[model samples]
Target chain A: MINRIRHILLLYLRETSFVLLFWVLVLGVLFAHFLFTDLDFHQWLVRYITTTQYPVFSIWSSVMLGAGIWITCLLGWMFKVQYAHPRSSLLPHYRSSHLMVGWICYLLIVIGAIWVIHVGGSFYQDTSDKQFAFFVAAVFFSAFNLILGYISWPTFAVVLWGMLCLFSNYEYFILTQILGEFLTNVFVLILTSSALLLLTWRLFHLKEEHWEYPYLFSWTRTSQRQHDALLTTLLDMVEKRLPSHQKHKPLKILRWDVLRFSIYKTILFFSAIILPFYLLYIKALSEYFLSFYQSPFKYFLLCAYSVIVIFGFHLRSISLWGRELLFPMERKRFIKEKGMNLLIQIYLLWLFLFILIILLPYMLLMPEFLMTAKFWSEILLTACFPLAGFGALTSLRDLSPRQSAFAFLGIVTITIFQMMQIKNLDVPILLMESFAWLFIGVLLIKMSYHKWCQTEF
Target chain B: MKNDIIDVKNVTKCFGSKKVLDDLSFQVGQGSVFGLLGKNGSGKTTLIKSILGLVRPQHGNITTLGDDPWCFQESTKEKIGYVPQMDSLYPWLRIKEMVEYTASFYSRWNSNLVNELIEDWGLNPQDRIGTLSVGESQKVSIILSLGHEPELLVFDEPVASLDPFARRQFLKTLIEIITRRPCTIFFSTHITSDLERITDHVALLHQGKIMFCGELDELKTRGNLNLEEIFLEMTR
Candidate 1:
């Protein structure tokens, strides 16, 4: 029993260490830069703290609640690969207590870490926020996290998703005016209690899950002929942009398992990112063109900014581009093909997303913007720049999504914020900005081609 | 009252319209050592996967331990230990850790036996499964499968990567286990002698169809040739 617990603990710790390392390295640098070089950043953060509608206690508790929920989710997900196969349940005499205890240990560590982050960030905070009510809220949030952590991961995932939906789109659930106000105030509590009840049932009544769904999303293993055609079409498009000599024999498509798994693997990230937009769009429709911050068009521009950041960050999925050793194609040609593939994929994705967004509640929310040239321009610039830039920049060097995502978002946020201050963006400014982004995007892509040519896979 | 531990009936599996297992039906009796043999891409692995519920056959029913292999219950799964042709051990885990983790799943785990086997196999407990040679990785996988002392052990080309000495030792182990515990073993292999030495019943899978499923001795007597020659003739 001790041995099993020890093993589980060790595994959890190892995973936790990797997670911590990424955060420390990224956040440490971010803090150092803002603390030292960027006085304006400090000013902005202070302003953000002061201008928020919520009081300090509410603010800190809300932050902790979000972190607590996220941490529980992370812990629950850490074992997914290890426990994916149903065979993991075949152990006959093993009790669920070990798993329960392991989850408790994870919860404690996470709560501690959250507290540390709270304390560290509140270096210049007032002491009034540390009242009994604040403590109660913190306790409640931590306790809720424990319940979430101990539940079956699929249950946790579903509940978490539902909670996010409820929190984001609760207005839809507000059946009556009297109940709606009450629901808004204690929705977190309601969700926590509901999850706890479900988890209690799961732990005792429904222990030994029999129903295991196959992957929700999977890549179809297409025919070799189909694969070949895909490659040929990709090559043909790329070849048009390349020198005549670059038009060579079709290299054997090294079958990437990623071709089958990438979307499913990244689905969690996709969902988490898209959920807010889903809610915001609903709110926009509800308020007749206004979201919390701006008009739906402007809010979508912000999302477009986000889309560019995501494209830049994820441009360097090494698996997507790392096939230099597998094929005999020259580096330039390989990079060109890869770049075109990425641009095409991103363009298709963004096009689909943009169309869907406009077709939905946003259709009624910003009905006039769809017909406007300004909106079209916004859509084009959003799709074109990132698609072009990432297509090129990623070719130059393999980049990590998490690390690069942060840096790219920071740059995009700062630039967008500055640009937003300019109340009027005339046609010339819009054209100039759009053209410049395209120029820079294309130039980087061209440079990346040369850079990749000389480098190893 | 069918006495068979495994029963496959008209199992037709297709991959992109190409039939991998076409109307495949067979039975292996309780405590019998069954050898599944076929040439590469002849659907040996696919058949095994179908039986294990890793892959679903479009038109067939498979029962192992008298329960449906497709969505088999934990109780049923506990009775069977399976090793695939290729090493499927978690790459990130050390051999020892993997053993311990795998043991946690089984109703019955013979820790002493697992330890003895790992030591006998000369596999380092601390070595990550990924760092080991293919042969060494296979040994770890074999140990994990046997740790629970399953009533039925299935191996797909179990000793394909092992050296001659290890192969001989493994065969010896199999024989000893079968005699002592009266367990059923269903394994696939390219090795003819290994089949000839241990398998009481041999089935030749060809072009997704069973060409022969009968007593090994009867097959040899009927063919008037060694298992190797019989295999070649059937496959050809």
Candidate 2:
């Protein structure tokens, strides 16, 4: 059983890098927290017992428990594979009994680790004035052990045990305030041991019984053909869009349009208009604004400006002209056609934003906050340049729907930085916005020309 | 005399360490119905995919209509029509919309023939492809494949999901189409009876290799037994 378990573990290690990476990340987090954080480790445990925020705690606990269940399930899966298809090449064949013994050994190591962490945390807490370093170490080790144990057990059992432990600790703290810490530690140990015993019994029953292995590994030939066909179609699509013989300039233009029009519309809308409005709403609801700011309307206007600038960038990005490849046209013709389409989309979006801005003063009941005609002209100029730059950036990135999530994050981060930088400028906000817009426009035109020159299709 | 439409030579494919198709070689002549017979895991589909240029083989060459299937040039692609084992039509598209959309891809699309097939298959032009039953979907797939008036047709397990009556009707339609056009029809199926009725040439594949490839009557005469018995004997 020990040998079998070792073989299974060895096979698992060979098969998956996810488990190794998971452990590495977990250990790294623990090490960092212990070395850097000023958090009181023992007090943190007490807080877990007393906390009433069940929703947050329950989610965290379930995540920990789910990891443990997956690990146990993986072991069962490996064992079944070995039993069904024994490797003749594996030297010094191990008995199933040896595997059972190995499982028990693994369980003991896990239980022992958990017991040590719990005992160490409790001991340090009882002896007040313990060094911060020692306390941190104890907490870190405890957290690591708890995580490992949770992953080692069945999913449901781990969840049940975690809930039981939390409630039992709470009850013990309430019933016996003086000896609560020690009693809780003892209870955790007892529960862990009992759960391990129950798991062992279950494993034994599973071993003795002739269980039907789920045929999860079987691949239907028809399904395989369909998958292959899809890949082939995708390859064909890609090849058609980016032909080998085409020059870089025209190909880039075509690629830009394709990326823009296909599945990027929703992303553009959210990043530009929707996201800015949400930020404005958040600012209005904030206590800082409510207490100090005289005009909530000004904040709304500012948000609207930010939205316009951000929307310009997104619009440019979405319209980078990649989609013209789908139609049967020469690279030069495709580039020209797509460029026209993009220009039209840009014009429409700008028109929509202009109309919205014009109506904002009346709808929002803050005519004074509205930009002056001169300010509007300056803002449009600044917005146009940056929007063009944003379009160029999007084309350069060749963004896909899968990468849109990360792109939105990048947009938000950039918007925050730009907004902060522009606020401190001595020049009028409108003028600054215009300059930014113009800069982006020049970049877009230059990039668009460069793309048309470089692309080969 | 050189009537071959598909000629695969020394074809090999592997997924990880397991070789799914090992040095496979075969040919399907023009104007003849070819049956590729294989068990559940045999490399029939892999061979079909390689022929269609869906999968690039690790080693060897496949020529379909005297051109690389992977090229998918307008002229090369126009010569062949394929009905995949599963329906590949966009489920959201209505029958008429799908036909029109597919028709756009081919220069030689026959709208009249497509309309005829739609009526023959009892398919409603306005119904979504997703709403169709398995047999109905197969009929739509067949209609789509035939709409382009290709010189060669490739179908993988065309009647695997069809009812007996539907299967018979599908075969009858297939036979009539092949007879009218004199196009090479390459179809893969597990059912030997279907092959026996319509197929002029047969290739029996077992464990990633062709057990036999010849005229169906020749194979029957050589073994002095029926095709089903011969298949079972060869596979075993």
Query: How do the residues B105-188 of candidate 1 rate in per-residue lDDT, one tens digit apiece?
Result: 565799998998888889889998778999999888888888889998999899999999899989988998899897999999
Pairs of colliding residues, candidate 1 = A91-B105, A91-B106, A92-B107
The top-ranked prediction according to TM-score is: 1
Report the C-alpha lDDT of model 1 over A326-383, residue by residue, as the tens digit.
6777666666665555555455445555554444544646577568766666555555
lDDT by candidate, in order shown: 0.60, 0.56
**DockQ numbers for every candidate?**
0.22, 0.02
Q: Is the docking of candidate 1 incorrect, acceptable, medium or high quality?
A: incorrect
Candidate 1 overall lDDT versus native: 0.60
TM-score of chain A of 1: 0.56
Q: Can you tell me which runs of candidate 2 are displaced by over 4 Å? A: A1-457
Error of 2 at A454 (Å): 66
Chain A TM-scores, one per candidate?
A: 0.56, 0.32
lDDT of 2: 0.56
